[model samples]
Target: MRLKDPMKRLNAGLLIIAFVLSLFAGRLVQLQGIDSGKYEALAMDQRLRRIELPAVRGTITDASGRPLALTQEARGVFADPSLIDPAKRTEVAARLSSMLGLDVQKVLEAISTPDSRYVVLAHSVTPEKGRLVLSLGYRGIGVVPESRRSYPSDAVAANVVGFVNQAGDGGAGLEYAQNKLLKGVPGWQRVEISAGDGQHIPMGEGQTQEPVPGQGLRLHLDQDIQWEAQTALADAVKEFKAESGTVVVMTPDGRVLAMASVPTFDPNEYAKADSSELQNRVVQEAFEPGSTGKVITAGALLEEGLVTPESTFDVPDHLWKYDKKFKDSHEHETYKNITFGGILAKSSNVGTIMASENLPDDKLYNYLTAFGFGAETGVGLPGETRGLLHPPSTWSGTDRYPISFGQTVSVNSLQMASVYATIANGGVRVTPTLVAGTLDEDGAFTAAPAPASRRVISEATSHQLIRMLEGAVGREGTAPAAQIPGYRVAGKTGTAERYVEKAGGYKGYTASFAGMAPADDPQLVVQVVLQDPKKKYYGGDTAAPVFQKVMSFALKSRKVPPTGTVAPTLKMFAD
Candidate 1:
């Protein structure tokens, strides 16, 4: 409203303009210098994309390098929820479900996660399907290279090789036991992406770290023998109407050539299998070895000079010891002056108890422990039970007598097999082993360390025991069915009262047989066990035949010829 000088007004306007420009300059300095890292991080967060590159899982191979469990090339379907149109998420999920065979709801839930930048919709998708998914060109949808676990042999060695879960973790068996060594290390990729479309920018700043592939496992298992043993065990289980069955084939030095369990599940479809079938019975399940356990007593007797193979015992039909009446497997007249060898050959409970009478309780327990009972065989398997063995201090008055005959003690099949293996190895107990070595990505093999070993009995005593065990497979012995043609077989039969937890007492019998071939100079040992057989439950009738079939195959496959020496006849009666 007042007339003013033009020059003054112009000067005042210039000063206001200078003040505004200074404020802007100060803000620029703060953003470019003081808060530069913070602002740059926010900007990069919007443009940078970090992707996970999955590591290729290892292969599980037999001793001959036959792949049992392997990993195959696959793809993982993922989504950027922020890039997807909110209104079209349902449609995208429906399309993805059809292409990937995924549940629409699950896919929808994954992609619809609030404020998620990346979401995994499915894993282990076939490459073809992944390409098909890419063909749709749906915004925010992508696929990354991945691996899928496969079992080419189906159910063969399933219990030992184990299966992988959908999340790519080991579910059981050696897979679970050695997962860290097998899974290896994962990697990653970082790249700049377009903010508008989320597509990786060409020639943009990018970095990739290659994944380290998992180390492969080479086992002592022979796939052929594994398949044979599995088939044979399954057949035996079905034929005998037994609840389950297990078999273990090992070298005298404790290399597990074949370990099989019946009712095994296919690792490919492990999701559909019952949890019970996933266990490896050879190492996980434990039961009384019965007369098969008598070898320990025999070792104790001979090692301590308590008795010789010719030591006589008047084995009665029944004997009362600490309020428990022990009887032979079958009705028989009193064995007048039966030799110690005859007691084991016949698998006589009363005779075994009588033979162990002079042996101290602590000494018997020591022999059992030394033979690897009540402890794991160190076979490198997961969930291996030590089995149940009470010390002499914990033994009840009757416990000593029953345990002397293998009644109170419990042992897994692998441990029982090692017993005969130890005896076969001239009394040295070699720790059982399944894995032969580990293989690198380039196929270089690193052999595992040698298994631990210790002397369990004198070499002379072992030879004598082997000779005595040969009588058990002879014509007059209990397990004639275990004999292989042209092979000098030696073994023991076991038929023990099976204790069932649900039944609260002994409900059925566990039939088992453990033997070594060419008894004159043992090379291989095999143990067979059947649980709760319906019809015939004798170890000689049911389990021995399996032992014969499996042992015969193993012997032939290994090219182990017979010793060509006839087994010397041992005295059954001293009189």
Candidate 2:
């Protein structure tokens, strides 16, 4: 009876265990056969969740590879309002406000919002401050790395390089012109985030995707030359008390060495500058070029074989006719019979008119057009204005004579420089260019396509013009200050009365100097325009000196060896 009772108990326990095992097996089969794929997919989704991380914008460099505009890492400081401890909130906010130069009340308000899960404490914090804030290990504070554009060169080529916006949009200069190249594709970072609060998942493996930085851009500008040109021009503007000024230096082959306009602004701080200061006046504004136009007229005459360097014009000190009467800049005691060289040397308006009177209007128009006038220079600079050159049909009565001497025609300073550059480069008219190359994300430079060029005139004509320009920079010429001690200097002086919008007449004068140095074998061609110098109104006195100083630096910086000695003093080569 006892043995039977024990067997019955053992059987009862085995039955209970068998029933439980059967229940567990049935549940496992249902989950594995029916819901297993869905649960696995959910786990994978959590593991593979991805978010886009914005890429950093590219750097802009000079031809020599000096950074003009660049980007660096910055930290974004944020706070979770709910997690901020009530007792420690005030202390935390106070410390953050002091460190960040923010108001404590602002910080408190940012953290006080009950509905807001996160608030920006600071948009961009220094690395030192970011590290300090992170070390606090507070429950609410968080730091995220962000990209910020920096101008390490600090406005050396601000107008040319431009700057970027908050959302990484290029604003002006190369930044605006080559935005597609500078802005790279944003990559992705797969971060394991908490399901409850979207915090960094602390206990699990996180994923990261390397950010793709933007492509770098190379400009045609030379940094040393740019610095020299900018400094000298700014100094000249300040010294002359002029309203504004521009300096452009270019190689004979049409490479823009430097272009600077003042009063200038820093690209890094462009937001604070006035709108007017941001405009690149050299390309955007067109003023009547005054006597600089004489170079075009002189070149046209020489190119057509109508006038030679020795060709003489019976020019008076003064010529009076229509509503406007013209005269040479300076009065001489003698009624001098001057040569073509003398006409250009003195920038004589009357002499230029006499030389151009016999030429047909069609030839004149064609000549100006060939020299890259009345049309865009194709420099690709933003806001470039095609200077105002009235065709034969557009010219009014008496416009021809005035236009011949660089009056009644408007042009940009850059256009004037291009004309000189073309003449310097042996009549080969190459398009002026600023960008040297564009780079990819991996720092490989895709060279900028070669600029288009055309032969505007014969080499013989360019040579003849150079000889004539040599006389112009001689002691007897108007631009004596343009003389370089060791090399041939050939250039022109321009003094034009500015057109007054209010009075409907010409008022103040714009003084300018355009020239090419080492005339025997041309290298650098520089053009400077000073608008409304208060004390000095003549180009020779005000603008030519600046050209000398700038070109001197430009020649040495380019390492252009000095040629045969400059003629004892700059004097007309009476050959």
Candidate 3:
């Protein structure tokens, strides 16, 4: 089809324009059909944001519902350096520093970084400070809610309660042990942000998830007893001028009423505290138990039919056996012939050795294991030690005599307290527990498992030892200071020469007393240990007084009726 000259020129122009429009149509289809999802995702990424909502930490309380640890509401301030105006950077940094206690130059340096989207300005910021920062109306600054850990009891049970860091992580003690149960599941939200302003869109237009708050912990510790113990221990440590000290108060059932240690630091100021001050010495420090171990030896002898309470032995002031010389705490001409019960009452090393002369070292070692030595108490508290208990194979020829009197054995104060507790529990060893129960997320109180118990001694043998311990607290016994008015108290005194690490010789002394109250029907087992008391290194003089004070206070506070039974006067010697 041939066209006229003018018509052909018009048709060519129209054909060219039509081809260009067709190309544009094909390009649009390819872009929309092939890449629609990718473009949509990129757009959403620019405007929509997902933010994390922090969950509340659990509360820690004593058995009496007294709060020990709590989580207080707080805020965290963050910044988007990319959004910060360079011209007003100094002004913003100075304002933040003044309000949040941050250094101005650091803030300036942080916001000056190029293309930085997020920078944490301050964690654990107070609500007041957060409000002040928000009032400044800076586009780059953002405030998120946070929590600050607090200890209500101060340093009373500081070692147990422990302190959390700024990021809300548990660092030590129960807090660390129960961290999994104490920290809850966090929530999240997906919201759209306005392009002009960095504010989140309304909830109806966004997706939100709620947080699950953590469970609460209820410890078995008694508030009244813990306070009494802390005060008494602190005072004794100071007065004795000892390097350190510890006290463990427990019920006959193995429920820990109080666990206290000296050189404690307030958890509120944990950052400024020395690491050494945070140690829980009751579970951490091991020392030779000294003559207090005679109770074990005496019990073993009676249980194994080697000696009766009335059995008599000609005990010399100096005992030479297995190529080692052992002497009593003091030399006395009249102490030659001592009865089995008299040996414990007087804390006589030579007399105990003579009583245990028939018993083998393996038999003694087995008994010690039954009494809860050589293993951790399994109280579930963090940083607990198993202590040192040598096997019979590790003992030398000279070891049997020394170990029988507690010279060769090492034990922590908690283990020592448990020894008395076993006797008080009528020869049953109960597992010590700190947590009585846990509060559910719904605020329901759920009781934890009852502490496990196993028989460590026969009831008959336990009674025999109890009677023997009563004599030790009598006026004729070693720890006369351990007597409580109107109460038949029974305990053993431990005075061991401390071993020097570098010199490998005897240096200072560790004085300790462990016993239970109302000796006939025991209720509480209390142990007080003073390490290296300069003035008086004798357990009778140093630790017995502390035991009396703490036990007396505990008895009164707990309203335990005193046993009207008079403490028996045990025979010091028998013919």
Clashing pairs in 2: 474-570, 474-571, 475-570
Q: TM-score for every candidate vs. truth?
A: 0.92, 0.84, 0.90
lDDT tens digits, residues 245-284, model 2?
9999999888998999888798777888887778788888
Clashing pairs in 1: none
**TM-score ranking, high to low:** 1, 3, 2
State, as a TM-score between 0 and 1, how close model 1 is to the true structure: 0.92
Off by over 4 Å in 3: 1-40, 47-49, 103-109, 191-206, 500-506
Candidate 3 per-residue C-alpha lDDT over 1-575 given as tens digits, one digit per residue, 9 for 90 to 100: 75679888898989999999999988787778778788877877766666666678889999888999988888878776767778999999999998988899999998788866557788888798889888899877877777878888899899878888766778888888898789888787776655543544565246769888889999989877888888998898888888889999999889998999888999988988888888888887888999887778877888889888988777778867756688988988756557888888888888877788789888999999988888998788788878778899988788888889998678888888988899998989998888999997666899998878899888899899999898988878889899888998989999999976667888899999999988889999999999888977899999999999999998898889986777667887865
For candidate 3, give the lDDT of residue 244: 83
Q: Which wins on TM-score, candidate 1 or candidate 2?
A: 1
In Å, residue 73's CA in model 3 sits off its true spot by 2.0
Q: Model 3: which ten-residue window has the lowest total lDDT?
A: 196-205
TM-score of model 2 vs. true structure: 0.84
Better of 2 and 3 by TM-score: 3
lDDT of 1 by residue, 164-272 (tens): 8888889999889988889899899987766666666778877899999999999999999898899899999999999999999999999999999988999988988
